[model samples]
Target: MSIDAIIMGIAFICIHLFANDLLPSGRIQRLKWFSFSGGLAVSYVFVYVLPTLHKEQITVKKYSDYLTMESELYFVGLIGLLIFYGIQKVVRKAQKEGENKKARTLFWMQILFFGLYNALVSYTVISHEVLGIQAVFYGLAVGMHFTAVAHDLWREYEDIYNRVGRYVLAAGILMGWIFGVNVSLPPVTETIIFAFISGAMILNVLKYELPPDEEAHFPTFAIGVISYTSITMSLKFFFQW
Candidate 1:
């Protein structure tokens, strides 16, 4: 295993495990923190993920003659978003109707799927040829992304998340890193995974950012977006990372 990649994986795991402590305690402060993270995550998606996705799409197109739709990868991305939305709907509906039993069952279901989602996204950390400063940038960007996602799960199922869900998601990151260390998936398969992750990540970040008007902090979020985007552009210019 590349030490840098392993450390990146550990960084993801830590964010999932200790996210609440890492976040602010006050309601308004927490909202602003999430808002900033949401902005950073979205900026990374547009600045980095999309360009990388283009390369993944090209690899997909080059490798597969039978599955040659230009938007096949995008369709997978859409599916990822839809899957998360569906889980959210089911959990909310069950809770709204006061079906505690159903909601509890669905809570596990949500955690499982979210863990898989985390794993898939984590796998890309190593699957991509990231190294040195590029790896650090990636960890910071996606670490913030995971923070928003973990907070959502924490809000949805705080008790269970504190007891078991966080550990499961943390384990998912470790598993993804271990798998990436052991098995090298074909470029086409890897690209498809990256596409799905991109879509899911976009949905997760936006979900928090577009919360109730009372909760949204546009100014902090705007700072996050602009600052992160500028830094990303500068890195691309100076280091070509």
Candidate 2:
């Protein structure tokens, strides 16, 4: 792995481990301006991630014999979204049930899925296809994603998150980097993984960004989305990254 990839992996681990500290708490947590982070993350999805997924589609087209449908990758994305959405539903239900065993079951299920997602995203970041600075920026986009996710899990099951969830996710960061460095999968497989991860990311960003009606700040969110979109667009045009 390059130094940048190593740096990113370690940073990601720290994000999982220390997200509650990194983010604001109590009343500040519910404020609308906080949605700015979600806005920045959503901006990346539209401008950078979706286009990258389009490019990955070509690779999937070139290599696959059976999965030849033009929209198959997109279907994978949809599947990813649905999978995480189901997890969220389960978490919500478990919370309402207020049963220790059921919630514990859901918590394990949640972390396992998120752990795999974390690993795959980290794995993709260090791919040869993403290059140096691009990898760093991609890592940053995913890092914002990780921050939101980590905070959400931390909030939902604070004790379990502190005890087990963060460690599993932290290991996922290391696992992804290890796999990325040691193993090289076919381009098509990597593309599919990226697509799924992107879809899940979309749901997570929207989930956190939309919050409740009383908490969401449209003007603040819009400003974040517009400004970041402009910045990313400018960078893409100027640098072709």
Candidate 3:
């Protein structure tokens, strides 16, 4: 892996470990930041990741006579979104049940789900050869998303999340980075992974980060959305990616 990848990994770990403390506790401030992060992530997905997938699909279509599924990546993305949604529902139900045996079981299940999610994200960051400025933008946006996730987890299960959940998620990122360095998937597999992540990111950001209008800072969110979108579009236009 490149030095940039290593740095990005360390940064990701830090985000999960310390993001809660870094941001203000005020609801409005937190919501604003979340909105910004959400915008950044959403823009990256819509502008870069999806376009890249489409380009790869075209390439795959031309070369492989047997593999003719044009929208396979998008399908996998939808699956990713649904899986996370289901996990969230289960976690919410568990929270409502309060302290019980079944609640504990579901709590652990939520941890496991997030661990896998973090691992996938780390693997994508390292294995995809995202370097330089693009990597910086992607990593920053993802770090913010992680911040939102950590906040939500803590809010739901403060004691357990503080004691064990954060560590599990952190370990997931490391494990993913290690695996990504050692093992490379085929092109189609890589594309599918990317698509899945894209779907998950969209759902997570939109669902959790953006709250009701009264709670959200529309100006801040709009700035974030416009700024990141402009940057991405500019990069694509000038670099012709």
Each candidate's root-mean-square deviation in Å? 1.5, 1.9, 1.8
Q: Clashes in each model (backbone N, CA, C under 3 Å)?
A: 0, 0, 0
For model 3, what is the alpha-carbon lDDT of residue 84? Answer: 89
The candidate that wins on lDDT is: 1
Q: Give each model's whole-structure lDDT.
A: 0.84, 0.82, 0.81
Q: In model 3, how large is the Cα lDDT of residue 164?
A: 89
| TM per prediction | 0.94, 0.92, 0.92
Residues 1-241 of candidate 3: C-alpha lDDT, one tens digit per residue: 9988999899888877876789887877777877777677677667777787788777666656776778877778899999989888877887676756677678778888888889998998887888888788778778888888888888877788888889998998999999899998877677778788778877887787776677767788888889999987888788665
Per-residue CA lDDT of model 1 for 83-163, tens digit only, reads 888898899899999999999899999999888988887788888858888888788888988887788789887999999
Candidate 1 minimal-lDDT segment of 10 residues: 205-214
Model 3 scores worst on lDDT over the 10 consecutive residues at 56-65
Better of 1 and 2 by lDDT: 1
lDDT of model 1 at position 182 = 87
Which order, best to worst by TM-score?
1, 3, 2
Pitting candidate 1 against candidate 2, the one with the higher TM-score is 1
